[model samples]
Target: MMTFYNKQTTEQKEFYENLLSSLASLSKLFSSSDTPYLHYRAHEILFCYAFGANNISRGDVSFDATKDGVGIGLKTFLHGNGNTFQKIAEFNSVSDEIRELGSNHNDIAHFIADKRNERLTDTLSITSTKEMLYHVITRNNQSLNIAECRMSFVEKARIKKVTLKKNNIYFKDSLHEYNFSLAKNTLYKKFDISENILHSIDVNIMGNPFQLLENLSVFDTKESTKTMEIILPLYSTSTGDVGRSSGLNQWNASGRERHQDEVYIPIPSWIHNQFPDFFNYKGKTTPSFMVKLPNTDLVPFKVCQSGGKALMSNPNRLLGHWLLRDVLKLQAGQLATRQLLRQKDIDSVLVTKVEGKEYDYELDFLKYGSYEKFEESHKE
Candidate 1:
């Protein structure tokens, strides 16, 4: 379980409080008896959820992570990417079904209370309780799917340097020590702030808590250095995919160790398409990052560790993610180049490459180890 901090800098904390209050009040305006155009209010509610990530990923860590765990940043993308969200109104093949359902529900709500006397189909239709539950589950599933798509990209990436301190709970591994903060810069690129600001005010406007030095003391913070990392969950994302992406948590654990007192640099993802140069920091080599599939045994698979070495026995077969500028290269001809994908040499045993069937972390986690490792050992 990744825990977040209740403590925060004053400015970061206040900005979050104001932003959250705005989101909540905007949502309630929908349920008002005098609400104008109910459907429009619903859109407003969604907009609040979608474009409001900086707030959710800020302030007290626990509160911040909850919003991020869902796909609340969606409004930002939907708005920026050529109004792709408005397509729900146009009802294209890929977007119509859900929107139609929501629209229909609004019509029903409008009709049942026309100030007249038409309490008619209360016995046969999808009741409000059923509708509410349906919406909850549907939104949750959608959020999960959105996450899969967002993490799918393994383009030019970067690993931010992170430090772990005491009284912080972290997932234990067999090799490297790891810690998580729902706050800024942990799994995202380090933000740039002035030296006077970093030392005196000490906060990240970019919402990257992993870069907060007055609040952090593990990684080396030598003048204006960008030290962050990428997260190594079981999930992987490539281009042009749909639905919830998968992870590799089924066949193995990170097998890394966690420390209660020791300080170590962790990894985060790249914000832009590039990253900073690497140095040989202890534990920066093997603990917090790695690339392994569900099965097909490989050795010396040290993607993240204390040293700056790639350190893999079968580098070609393993699908590890690295800071974009760190290890990936363009092959010249192929239009769709790849990074953080399965290595080239390792034999792929695909009985059938279906969802949760071949190599993903989440399915394996939910079905096997957390459930009991489901195996069909080969007789050959």
Candidate 2:
């Protein structure tokens, strides 16, 4: 029942309208048409700004933003007859399994529904959000429409009918309609705009929007800032598996009987060579620094062990407790395996240096194969 549209104040609505108008004014830059187009990232950021919410799009979770314990998935698309099917999920990694299910519509529906539910459950666990909903924006010739609806899990058990036509599979549950594209390996949910539209605002597209940019003097400044970040794999890259005596299973590391919380995130040597100044490490002492968790708590951390290979919480147990127990829902002695990580669709942690008066960093979850993409982007 957590609705973003119903909870917006007049001031917030005004701000949102103004933001959309400003965005619409730049439509001519992309297209000659008067119809306004809103970029998805801009929608996510501006929505968070207007509503005083935290933007979690970079986390790559099911939801893009969170407010009042509610996780919201923001969507923007062209308006069509107050009813449209927008993509909600992609299953490229599991497309083979879906194809193997063949013409068995019931089995395909169940598989897709289960995968969707798993993603939602994992997102909720990581973000600690109580509810999930979709806050959508639909663009027309001269206006933008806003709508909100519950992001419900597909009722797999109650799927009454399913149809397969060409490369698309269509199904209906008690709550909603769904479509799976075999060619694209994607899932889309139908949104009824007429029933859900809470607000509509007219966008007056400026004829000479370039003049507005020309008048701005701030663009002349040369100073720029970029976030320093890196992604570390959860499993050992050399062995291609979660080592029984290392990584998340560090408690099983030989030599000394370990506490249940004895675990550390492995930092590759290349990171130390490339960004030597990123971590404050000198000689033998482990220099402690603060790390902001996704839940907004600042916890002490340090680079320890020979060659600064391990990044761990101050007591070495705090990070493990959160990553292994809380997020992954693993028991005290449960071994964290690479298969388990892949099953959850997360295999790495994104560490971003927090720019402030104090030396600190922030951590977020990244889906599997993200580290390779990050590496490719940084390749010299």
Question: Which candidate gets the maximum TM-score versus the true structure?
Answer: 2
The local lDDT score (0 to 100) that residue 18 gets in candidate 2 is 89
TM-score of 2: 0.92
Q: Stretches of candidate 1 above 4 Å error?
A: 1-62, 65-97, 106-234, 238-249, 252-380
Best by lDDT: 2
Prediction 1 global C-alpha lDDT: 0.22
TM-score of each: 0.19, 0.92
Candidate 2 lDDT by residue in tens digits, 1-380: 45787788989988988898888878887787767979999999899888888777888579898877788999999987978788999887677788898788779888999999988887887777888999989998989998888799888889867888887889999888999888898899998868888888898888877888798866643443336888888888778888898889999888977889888888877777777777856645477889877665578999988888889998889888888877888998899998898777788889988664243787888887887787677745
The per-residue C-alpha lDDT of model 1 at residue 240 equals 19
lDDT for 238 (candidate 1) = 32
Question: In model 2, where is the ten-residue run with the lowest total lDDT?
Answer: 218-227
The regions of model 2 sitting more than 4 angstroms off are 219-226, 280-286, 356-359, 376-380
* lDDT tens per residue, model 1, 122-148: 100101111100011001111210111
